[model samples]
Target: MSAVLDIGSHKVVCLIGQQDSNMGVRIIGSGFGVSAGLKGGVVVDMDAAEVGIRTAVEKAERQAGMAIQSVSVNVSTRSLRSQQMEVHTEFASGEVADRDLTRVIESSLSELAQPEDAILHAIPLNFSVDGEDGIRDPRGMFGSKLGVDMHFVLAGIGPLRNLAHCVERCHLRIKSAHVSPYAAGLSVLTDDEKDLGVTVIDLGGGITTSAIFRDNRMVHVDAIPLGGQSITNDVARGLSTPMEAAERIKTIYGSALHGADDDYVNIPCPPMGAQDTLHHHPKSLLTSIVRSRTEEIFELLRDRMTDAGLDVYAGRRIVLTGGGAHLTGVREIAEQVFNKRVRIGRPNGVLGLPETIDGPDFAVATGILKAQFMDIDEAISGPPDLSGRRYRQRRYSGGPVGRSLQWLRDNF
Candidate 1:
């Protein structure tokens, strides 16, 4: 069995499951808790974050009827950045081999020189032999030179260490950590969407993150500091209501688009401090507030994509996930801003999810579970090793070669 924990700005979720004989995941246990001590997906208070993690993990353990000592966690931060580059090497034997593949990947890692940044994922998108490009695997092929296009996701070392310390304080060992948007894409994206090109936006409470996938690999990752929490704050200030009441009202009646009958619908709001006084406002006012903030988010995202030259890679499809995707008319607003086909994506391919939690909000958690069985090139941890033995071992254990060998032994 395997376990994954998704700690977001708004909530913490834990899922325990196992891979079945048919290669599908069957979820056996799940639990969640209200998140605190985290803002913008980074740990702010160690004690508070540890409490939340322990609560969620204990619930999952109770349901699964087993204690877990380690878990795969999700990481999300505004400081996360994406970089794409190409690296090349000449094969010593005039033919591509496993060592050549390892050498090229290591060279890509060496290109990064930021001391404050930590590498989260190093993905080899495609390879080239001599002058020809778009090769998936160059091993055993005759080529004097091997080249690779690599994508990397990086985050601030300070934030990552803080998060890891918090999790450790809860007495849980870290099995692995995955970026938020990357994990969401793994859970919600279709094979065709990934192959053709697609953008996945995870709209969370305190941060909004996105990942671009093409040719069955993630190409870019980016995040903004604003999210659904910002919208709730706007509602609270505009309506003179408490934060809890504003959040409740937003969840119950928020819409990103105005309706003709909105003016006829009235919503009652109690003053921030007064318990008996009530003010009645038209729904149109609420709609206006929500729509403004939601539009700003999409507009910022569009500009970022254009500035990074990633607009072309986004293709014509966009998938929206996370808690913010639940707001009414969010899909329509995304379509308007990006001028692309948009859909609200929910977690798919996993069994035994409760209806109450089976929504786009849970995409990150579900994706973390799915990633456990994927290829090594899909996600790699950093800190270069000179011997290259670690990279070779990991490739053989989790890469295509390992799976093929296992299949052969089982069938033969």
Candidate 2:
């Protein structure tokens, strides 16, 4: 089993998992730690984030009775950036061999300039052999030259360095890193949504990450820095409650669809040891605060969708996942805005995962395990197949963060 860790703004989750021949993953153990030095899914204080990671990893190791040195992590701050690049290469030799083709593809990718942007990810989108598009792999195909399209996600340099440094300090080998929103997509997206078209909105505590998927490819990825955490902050200020109490109220009674009664809601506004409670009606509180912020977030998402010009069907769908998705009436709010069938998706297919960890919250971690299994199968799909590990070497240069399939894997 491979040990995977998800360093989230809310918590650090670790899991020991692996897949069988059936392409199904079985999680043997899991651990979590309170996040110390992170905000909105980005590491703001390096030392604190390292402490959180160490605590979580050590707990997972103890639970599994084994040591783990390497792990896959998720990145999901609004600071992340992505772009689609197409590179072309010419074959010096006429023969079609695997190494020759990989070199050409890798070299074509090497020309891709990584500016001030640190690499969030470098994923092979699709290959075009001699101008043919949509070729997943072209090992034996005859082509004098090859052209390829790759999707790369980059993060703001300063925030990214903080993350890398924090993980390094924890003594975890970064096998690969995945954008958090994209990682969420891997666990919850349905096949039909990917085949036709859909959007995934991971309503994280600090950021609302969005990705568009069509033709089984991730056409776009982006995020808004504001998320559920903002709402809680607003509640805390408006209701004059502690941040902890605001979070409690938001989780227990938050709703997106404001009603006339919302203005009449008398939230038990508790202050620092005061006998008289501040009586604020729910509607008055929501309209000026909660609804406004949620609408703003939805409008921002709408703007992003419009900018992408995605190929969507009439019943185009949206998958809502993450802690914010639990807010009442969230699906309805998203449906009206996107004009699509919206539903909450949960990660449902693991074998040994505990019930406590079985929910939309686990989507990114579940996707991480599933994605690794997919890469392994794809790597060994070529000819000269052997049942045992003796015949083939496990390729290390693989990661599971992209492709449109991520749209479903992410959100609830």
Candidate 3:
């Protein structure tokens, strides 16, 4: 059994489930609550965030008829980013051994500057032996020089500690932490899309995240602090409406592409104060505001993708996920700006979710559950020593030595 807690800027989702046959997870219980004490995916009020977390978890527990002691959470706050590190070593007079693989993977950690930021995911993209690339497993292969290309997802230590503390306050343990965009990609991306290369753009409330994947591994990840919330704020300020009414209008009448008769549709805008009366505005005006802001976001995304050196690797394909993806006509706008084929990403291969929460909004939580069953470290917890402690976590999965060491620890 496992639990997944997806803490976002707009909502907190908790899911309880168990691993079933064929490496699939069946969701038994799910709960979600309006997010509080968060701004742009970072917790601003620890107490408020803790309360929300406890409420969601308790709801799921009640539904599952079981208590959850720990959970896997998603991390997207504080500039979540990915970097590439390459390591090469020469073998002396023999075939490559498990120790050689371990050494090369360990050497890649040197790319990290310090302990203030931790690697959320260390994915071994590929291995090369004797200058021949694309070796899935390098063990027992004779090669004088072995090389590795490692992709790492990193997050700031302070934000990570704060997130961990919030979860602990609910009397729950964090089984593991995963990068948000990576988790979303895990749930929604198809095998063909991953193999051919694709980018996932998570249209979240407080942050818009982009992740590039190729050969079934995440190669790049970047985030822009602005997201759906920014658009809502723009609506509120532009129409002189309250936050609630602005959000309502954005959902009910907003569109990224204007229609021929949008001006004929007038949406009722509730008065700002109790004494004020109702006001109405042309729906076209509302959509125009949304379109302008969304365009800016898409343009910024284009710039970021190119700046990351991932423009070519992404291969002109994109998958949109998260709450903001629900906006009508967003796919068209994104396609125009990115010049790529764009489609909405929904969580697949999961069972037993209420129709209400089974959309792209919950992709991260669903992905976390999927991660647990698949043994994807991006889904499972890594070393548990990320709390600004002196203890360090080691990586061994890239080679046989690490696997043997882990097996001994488990069996001993």
Candidate topping lDDT = 1
Expressed as tens digits, the lDDT of each residue in 350-394 for candidate 2 is: 778788887777788877766666652111122111122222122
TM-score of 3: 0.91
lDDT of 1 by residue, 1-412 (tens): 9898999888899999988778588888898877888999999988888888888899999999998888898888999999888988765445677777876787677666356777778888889999899899888788778899988887887888888888789888778888899999999999999989999999999999999998888988999999999999999998888898999999999999999999999988878775568887888989999999999999999999999998988789999999999999999999999999999999998888889778999999999998886655743553222233444454345568776675354334
The lDDT of model 2 is 0.70
Backbone clash total for model 2 is 25
| Poorly placed runs, candidate 1 (over 4 Å) | 379-412
lDDT of 1 at 102: 75
TM-scores, each model vs. reference: 0.91, 0.83, 0.91
**Segments in model 3 whose C-alpha atoms lie over 4 Å from true places:** 110-113, 377-412
Clashes of each: 0, 25, 0
Q: RMSD, each candidate, Å?
A: 6.8, 9.5, 4.7
| Residue 284 error, candidate 3, Å | 1.3
- Full-model lDDT for every candidate: 0.86, 0.70, 0.84
